[model samples]
Target: MKGKDHFLVAGRITWDFRRLSEEETDWGNKILFLPAAKNMSMLVVESSPWNANDFGIPYPTYFHPAKDSEVFEWQERMRSLERKWLFSFAGAPRPDNPKSIRGQIIDQCRNSKVGKLLECDFRESKCHAPSSIMQMFQGSLFCLQPQGDSYTRRSAFDSMLAGWIPVFFHPGSAYTQYTWHLPKNYTTYSVFIPEDDIRKRNVSIKERLLQIPPEQVKVMRENVINLIPGLIYADPRSELETLKDAFDVSVQAIIDKVTRLRKNMIEGRTEYDNFLEENSWKYALLEEGQREAGGHVWDPFFSKPKPGEDSSSDSNGGTTISADAAKNSWKSEQRDKTQ
Candidate 1:
């Protein structure tokens, strides 16, 4: 796409940089080459907006936001069956960080009678299935969701999809980052306990969830079920799907952004139009070179009006402009890059 004249596409291609040293301590040589990919993209569809902003790249939307096909099934199955356990945790300890919140939560949760700690031994036992993790969530009223390898964990969403209320230990785990996808007020469906508080044993996750009345917990579970559709990137080929999935929303947003950019350029409000117009002569040269290179006639870079051509003026004769004319400014950029 660099030279073929295509819009740059990017995704959340990296891990949580803030905790990189802790998470990627094993990657001695690879760590140095990781951050070099920053700003190499025009638009990014990422999970953690906090990390996206930290990288200083334009992330228009959050895509493929942690959802699964078995989600509805889990939710339905858990709904009819009474939740047997008060709380549950299924993840292993992050031994890299000696004082990790996950490790602390595991220890504390195991000691408490109200909590169930399932030591996920999938790595050790080939017989252990991943569905067992969902089973744990399904039977629990609340699920302990601490940050895993990254600030964001897929388990939090999995817990919710299982019709269990997620108890988040870190703000980055789900609260501040996923504003576009999650509820504006997080407390509506999930619980937020500061990582510091949880680590220090200052706040008991069980005590807090117990304080939430049964009726409120019912409301929260319903809210979590309702959120499953939007959070999921539904199978596009599935005709049974009618809801707006994450993929549908992200593609629509990209279309809307391009439309807005084209509109602003036509209306002479875009910063690129004038700058490109002043250098319209370069487009002619670029167009000739592109044509020689077997480029298509519909290239956006060659749409600018020549020095004395009819500049698509407004209805009030305020200077005419076409979508072609609007996109003319990009030619110089492409030309410069070609050299």
Candidate 2:
């Protein structure tokens, strides 16, 4: 940890305080956080760590992943100096929050801001980022997932959920991580003009969405309507808890994982060894490796690796030496964990 400069968590520190469960009385040695937090500064706590998006009555415990899964393994490999925790206090926000992010988006669109841009009231509008997000795939055409303080967020899943397509602010942010499942022209979905371009022109962000093709706009709207069957989960079906079933399931899963980890700890089992076994979060390891190798194979940076009339005969069927190394190690433990 000292040498590698990773997240050094010393003790039970509160990471996601908004939806912490009552059953999760304390921390655990392991937890599964969103992919957005994978490479960030973090720590291991003996008490249970919280997944902010998941919560509800009777608890949605089934879908929570294990601490020793691909997600947690990535975090475990990160190295950082630890910070100590003390005097823990706890409270969670109220449920069915009309103040939730999606609700706010609906409110904004329902209001006249976008319809009449220049005359719109920007000062009176409040920002609508809910502390704990539920998937917005069902009712919304575009799941307005701009960056949250950094490069990525789980809103990509919201895109996948509705297939409404993501509207990214940065072109090179991790949408490729979503791959072909992403709809056509998702680049159009995201506006990539530099921030300087906006400041110099004094453009409002909403005005840009208006310029996108009308056909594409209609397609995004239609996609959200279609995703209703796939992602608008109301499985258990109780009235007051209308949209909360899936969120409940997510919380329940975290509670279950924490319970198992704590029980194993008390019975003298180490979760760390299990933590090492999971290493699959690289989801694009082979693709990235091949891309790197292709660059080097003809690399203007190098000499012999480049192809030539004689090189075809000198090498194996014209495949560069870099190609073999790339394919062989595309799946090594070090590559998977640290790639």
Candidate 3:
């Protein structure tokens, strides 16, 4: 199985078994849930952060594409709409979760005169209404996309669908994920406010957004609107001859990745033969130079917490896996394979 071509299309959610029960963890380990270098022949296309050998595809958005002409028309319409709010956020507060900054975001949006808040609590029916959500997004210049249950949210894609720029709090929310769909330079399509700044009350979201020049904002919004075609899934019943939807983009990326992998394997390039799968995010996605580089822009956000400390206490809301644990897991698996 070393060089056999295989592919695993992970369903909607990306599976990370770090917090699972002991029994479940054992089950996951046996099945290669935490895939290592040996699994290089197998391409795991998932929606979560995984090894460089695998691919990260975008979560499907509610928006469905029909043709390029309709999409272009919608983009023009969205551009012409009068944006009343500087920034808006639509999410439920997680008061029980100390790491979450939703409450802070809610309070800030409510207090700021330029911001709009759509609190999606038990009573907010509009939160579930797609039309209402799109309306809100259409009226806003920026949509706040903080980490939900997972780092990635459908809302980010939805916001982009409305031709509004999404403001992310974590790199995992967009920067690290959805590489195939979104622009490599995150600033071209979206804005990022460090979650730590919000947690520490050190920065004002409104003030920060206002600092960006109008000309720059226009360029970013256009970039986001242009991304709508690639982000959405086209109605399967109808073909999108003029544009490539999410499906097309994802499939093409998988093909390209597999082709490169097959070439490397055939050519006897041993670099990835024993490459630590855990560092794929760093080496494959984040840094082109890898070890020789100083560091990635997103490096500061993914720092590991000290021993006996919860990762939430760190800057990035404690959602990412620790590098130490990832390295150890790969080493242990390699030893098991050798034995």
- lDDT comparing candidate 1 with the true structure: 0.53
The worst-scoring run of ten residues by lDDT in candidate 2 lies at 83-92
Off by over 4 Å in 1: 1-13, 16-75, 125-128, 257-339
Ranking by TM-score: 3, 1, 2
Instruction: For model 1, name the residue pairs that clash.
Output: 311-320, 312-320, 312-321, 313-319, 313-320
Q: Write the per-residue lDDT of candidate 3 for residues 242-267, one digit (tens) a residue.
A: 78998898778767766766787788
* Model 2: per-residue Cα lDDT over 143-177, one tens digit each: 44432212234444434333344454332233322
Model 3 bad stretches (over 4 Å): 1-4, 16-19, 24-54, 270-274, 286-294, 305-309, 320-339
* lDDT digits (tens) for residues 63-157 of candidate 1: 23233445566446657767888998877676754436677788878889879887853245311445667677778888888765444455676
Report the error of model 3 at residue 49, Å: 3.7
In model 2, the Cα lDDT at residue 245 comes to 32
Cα TM-score per model: 0.60, 0.30, 0.83
TM-score (C-alpha) between model 2 and the true structure: 0.30
Total clashing pairs in model 2: 16
Which candidate's TM-score is highest?
Answer: 3
